[model samples]
Target: MIANVLTIAGTDPSGGAGIQADIKTMSALGAYSCSVVTAVVAQNTCGVRSFQALSPDFVAAQIDAVLEDVRIDAVKIGMIANAGIAGAVADRLTHHRARNIVLDPVMVAKSGHALLDPEAVSAVRERLVPLASVITPNLPEAAVLLDRPDDWSVPAMRAALPALMALGSDHVLLKGGHLEGEDSTDLLAGPEGTQAFRAPRITTTSDHGTGCTLSSAIAALLPHHPMPEAVARAKAYLHAALAQSDALDVGQGHGPVHHFHALWASDG
Candidate 1:
């Protein structure tokens, strides 16, 4: 049967990231996508200007409605915004005993705007991370989640994975993309061990939705695919999406990776 994935996230009116990106990713990968909007942000390729989070009760309602009818194969979470939303998510998932939860710890946008509230960090750590099937955090996000200082290095980042695992997630994907380096390396640190993927850094400004895209890809591959395997596959999938989107026209500042790149290439 085809995978049915749910993405609980914010909405980007520009449709470059958030729920738009998740749905695009799932569709590109042949999975049906269900979305629950946690917040609505007034954003463009330049940056986010303002945002409003959904009521925590409404957030819980969306999840309950989806789960009551659809047998969700996996769930991808992004841009939860604040503790209220985080608590709402945690409560619903815990009650349902949902499986294959992929948590993308999104802190800041590619435009350097803060995407998560500071107070909500603890909520995500305590309520969400423990239940996540895999937690994917880019260097800065990982540092924030683990309280690693600003000067943390790759080795230091690598060492923190175990501590993160102790937080209760079965697998922790520490993304090295934010590190200062020629190549971006992402590590899948889990009980099985660490699996790393290093790719040549593509120097492009079109990279607004990477975290959302990666988490959604991971979700679409889960339960049927092992954590390590899913991490590897997701990286490759996102790489292609980025490469194919290299020249597409979108919003003026940092554009989005072309989730339908594969389809465009195949038709050519």
Candidate 2:
């Protein structure tokens, strides 16, 4: 049976990030995808112009509507704008005993637009982080969550890993793409200890939705694979998507990675 995955996040009309990217990643990874829009953003590969968030009650209603009927194997959450919405999401997830929860702490956009409100950071940390099975944070995001400066070096990330895991996630994946390097390395810390994942950096302006895609891909794979294997498979999938990033020309700025690269390359 196909795994059923749900994404709770904002909308990116450019279809390069947020819920759009999440759904694409889920479907490409062979999962049935669904979504609840937390905010509607006016953005493209370049930057975010503006955003309008939905009410917390409405967001909760959407979650209730889906969980009451669907058997969701996993849930991927991204871009929750404020404390209220974060609380709403946390409550619903707790109530449903949601499995395979992948939380992407999406604070800033690729173009440096702030997707999350500063006040909401505590809510996510205190209310939502503990509820997540895996929390994916870039170097900068991890710093903000820890109330510190951004430090992208490998040693810094390693030093910060235990602190991040302490925020209550079963696993923490600290992304190293923000650091200057030929290889992008990510450290995953959990009760089983830490594992490092490395991939040659793909030089392209088409990495708009990388985080959303990676976390969603992990969520899609979790029902069938163990945590470490799921993360490994997701990284492989993301690397393939980035390798084929040049195929799409969606906007004048950074374009989106090709989510369905496998299907596009299929000879069948």
Per TM-score, the best of the predicted structures is 2
TM-score of 2: 0.98
Best by lDDT: 2
TM-score of each: 0.97, 0.98
Query: lDDT value for candidate 2?
Result: 0.93
Kindly list the per-residue Cα lDDT of model 2 for residues 125-207, writing each as its tens digit. 99999999999999889999999887568998999988898899999999999888799999988877899999999999998
Candidate 2 stretches with Cα past 4 Å from truth are 266-268
- Candidate 1 scores a C-alpha RMSD against the true structure in Å of 1.3
Per-residue lDDT tens digits for candidate 1, residues 22-131, read 99999988899999999998998899898899999999999999999999999999989999999999999888778999999877888788878999999999999999
**Candidate 1 TM-score over all chains jointly:** 0.97
Candidate 1 local accuracy as lDDT? 0.89
- The count of backbone overlaps in candidate 2 is 0
